[model samples]
Target: MELDLFRWRFVHWQFMLTRPSNYTAGNIGGSVSGVKIAFLGNGSYAFTVTGNSNPDGSIYNSEEAITSQTTGRLYGAIFVRHWDSYITPQRQTIFYGSLKKDGSQYALSKVVNVLKGTNLESPVPQFGSTDNFDVSSSGIAFVSKDPVLQPAIFTKINAYFVPLTDFTVASPPSPIQIQTSGFNGQATSPVFSPDGKQLAFLRRKSVQYESDKLQLFVLTDVAEPNSTINALPTADQKGAWDRSPSSVFWSPDGKTLYLTAEEHGRVALFTLEPPSVTANSSSLPKKVFYDGAISSAYPLSNGDVFISGSNLVDNSIYFHYDSTSGKSNVLSSNAKNGTVFGLSRSQISEIWYPGAAEGTQIHAWVVKPSNFSATQKYPLAYLIHGGPQGSWEDSWSTRWNPAVFAEQGYVVVAPNPTGSTGYGQGLTDAIQGEWGGLPYEDIVLGFQYIEENLDYVDTSRAVELGASYGGYMTNWIQGHDLGRKFKALVTHDGVFSMVSQLASEEQWFPDHDLEGPYWKNPSSWLKWDPSAHTANWSTPHLIIHNELDYRLTIAEGLAAFNVLQQRGIESEFLSFPNENHWVLKPENSLLWHTAVLDFINKHVGLPTYSEQSSYAKQLRSEAWQNRKGDLGRKV
Candidate 1:
């Protein structure tokens, strides 16, 4: 049996198993020769394809071909049936079974009705490695919507266990419900301990709040039908500790659980040992590794661990961590030569400075030009990340890339301020409802610190750029005292008015992040409203808005541009009528970069190659011709 890599997303790898001899032998009958098995991300379902391999070793090319195949299967399928009035809601039935070849077709064996309900108020099952389910030799542990909760104001998710034996029998036994009493929030990523006595999972209070942090929990007596869940005490619960924790691995002794968590500005490794009930000892989680952001980790039988992570200067790289030496050795990387984005001489470094709040520290990434020199002053491009809850990770991004700015002879500084993840939960939670308070202060102070400390930086030639939440910050900065700090500003798909943003597609973001709905607290809505301070705007601005940006809505960008035009500020509006919140298409992205770089060059001096390079000349000519054509048509 050979397992071939099918698809990879984030840290999860989906595989397809193939039996080479079975295809040619035609043991399964008909045109279909082999069984192709595929597993979903969260193991919610497993699909099988029973089809013939072509000359090129590919199968199931079309819908007709798939239907004509010898067999097909869908495990753990949920069926919904609607009845009565349209508002009465629908009934759901979950089915689980194995597929077997049955006379030129396929049949489900040991078919089991795992769950059935009318008006089941539960979250849709998340089929991935991080979100919902895991399977072991003993049983299958999964996170499912709690059917008991009604009205579904906030869907409550709970952990469930079904014995492996139940699937083999004609009638499956009722799944054992692992009660999460104290922690009645959402639960996910259930991983059984090596001894099978305890199960570890991540719990969040509510789904309404985007900033809600996931805490680690270990359920004792997991074998019992009713087990008690205890929150594992960690050294830094306040810091977004264990925020988005996944890929749980247990030590060989079953005494310690190792997992990857976001801390400060990186996704590092941490370990937690369940406290003893008799001794009442403190069993806090401790940081075991601090190299960079770890995407995935797997423990080996020999006590060593394999990890895939990236630092401030590199992309995804594989490494082996030695348990005894406490050292990590590089195994492989896409850019093993230490070059990134084909820029061999560029450098990246993490810079820490005193945060806006006294005694607090802020972190940011600084990308220097490939030909950086201390004697000459360089223009700075201060990049802000979206997701006031998101971070400037030690990873590479094609969109909003700092390296591109660096390649253009500009030093880039991306700060992970308050509310950014990977830091402790406390810092992440501090920015909620105070969007323009601590987080804004952090960004301003971060720039001030960089300006004061970095003598090679030309603060007067700086340009501030951001998208999404970062765009919101850029809007806020344009109206605040910090607006005078930068020579030019760029806001893309950002929120302009807090109250108007309530009309966004995602209602939960404003409901929780902004404290509540506009009706509930009208005054709070005006606190971060950039429209209210348009009188103070004086900076040259470039506004980018997309038609399909339902998250922040195109209206928000329109409102900001209206203010810029009304205030007579030197501004330009770049609208992507065909794109969404993000400009993803190749041609559109190229146009975006060209326009943005042109705007920056217009304010700050152009790079040395801008006038000489044929590509730059062609891009400028194309832009000019398009603008002239638009003006001519209007006349």
Candidate 2:
């Protein structure tokens, strides 16, 4: 077999937005034969044609981009999904190319560039931040910047028609207008109907900071924007800024539009009939369905719906019927091992993955006490997710610290609430900008559901814990809803004040999040700041943050801690000296988990859980043996 190096510069390994970079292999199948590895940069990578096997034990007789960098740097790069890759002579980078299982090459007509001096001003870290183009199986339609249109949010968020064949963008493309002056909110999820004739999207015309309200707009076009179009605000739903739609998806037939909205912090599903190509604004909006506290809803190919709910015991995704059974089934109930056990049968509590809420189809693991018994209910620790848009899946981690708490008799429950991905795009965008609102309610309701439904859980001994966005929610609970309900709260790398997060990292504000900077709308910042209710905090809190975290800097954590202390509230602050946003080193992770278990135990009156396990003891013993010669003499 002949092997081919994917690129001339193996050292410059590039990561794709959707897949891993096995540059050693020219294609997605595996390493090719006759390829030799060569170092392009001080051995950061190796371009070779040899019989090198991957982690799966398959011989990879091809080139490889192995990391020769330090763990801190390597892990950091992988964390951000940036890798080395070749830059084309056209000055085009892989960032514009699409790679799929089948070899096919397609490029964007023009890359979306963040205007200089804009929020996307910061250069990507040592590892680049830009993602290589991703080709969707079905073609896509986007709104692009045209000097004439001058879309308010961008020069353009182009609506290039990506053809499924060869996955190429159509030439002389048709474009749409996404942003215009006086728009309250940014444009979100542009979805075309199944027939590709109608389009639906959620737009915020304006965002009010104090009340956290947004003006919603829905535009429809029968053919293309170039043709006659019917664009206007939706009158089907109330026009209140406080209750704007978050996610919009079209049915397979293009007859229905599914939307998720937050009402008093609870999410509900609403189906409406969007205006047709021939119909004008005269069509009335009708709600075909409704579910209070619906976390997420996904549309499947067959028209069945997969809904990941926020209700307890109902966290799993449910398959709703259009023609099939009216009820949904739980997919997570199929996993056999609820808790992972180590070599000695001692439960490795941290190894547990969570399942979806009880009735939904999604699945996640729960870490429970090694010595726990049904007779003695345990205090529950709810591990909140950060991305608020990310999912809690079954995977291994060295830092989650679940086992440490489980060993101490704490029932650790991590839920894949609404807004988590892997379910579908509709579910993923359900909580945009509605922070401290429905997003917050889903979590609280989840905890309540677990306490009421799970026989092994004790409501009186519950705690709320999370990092980053999860951290933000933990702090929110301390001041808004669960201040008195939760026995203790633990926030890691979370935001206390949105104003500070936006101001501290101004360069990141525009592109990644925030329609504009804090200065443009300072009230939005003040309204969402958890510290605004600091005077109301009653639960003891433990604030953990990394000194070097660029996302949520230590200063943010310190400010919140200081205010809590000043108010005579019970709070403690702990900072990682050399770590970043996520504490990755295994030893450091052990320490972090141990400290969390200790803190929660102290507050909840549970017995202390030792951080040390048999694995730790064995590692220490090996270390001592290696250092025996330095002892000078045996004791």
Candidate number achieving the greatest lDDT relative to the actual structure: 1
Q: Write the per-residue lDDT of candidate 2 for residues 412-454, one digit (tens) a residue.
A: 7876665555444344444545567655666666666676667
lDDT of each: 0.66, 0.50
Q: Candidate 1, which ten residues in sequence have the lowest lDDT sum?
A: 79-88
Give the best candidate by TM-score: 1
Question: By summed lDDT, which 10 consecutive residues of candidate 2 come out lowest?
Answer: 87-96
Q: Estimate the overall C-alpha local distance difference test score of candidate 2.
A: 0.50
* Residue lDDT tens for model 1, 1-635: 22221121111321213322212111221222112222323323232222223332332233334333543433332121111111112222233344334553334343333443222211242223333555444555666666654312243567777665333354545567777554556677777666556677777767556457666666666677455545554343332344566456777677767878776667778776654433322555677777767878878777778898876556668889887787888898776634645554247777998887777788998888877888988898999999988898776565787877887888889999988887666677878788888989999988888789988889889999999999999999999998898889999999898877656554556777778778897777798888788889999998999886666778898889878887788888787767877888876777788778877767778653445467756765675576543543210
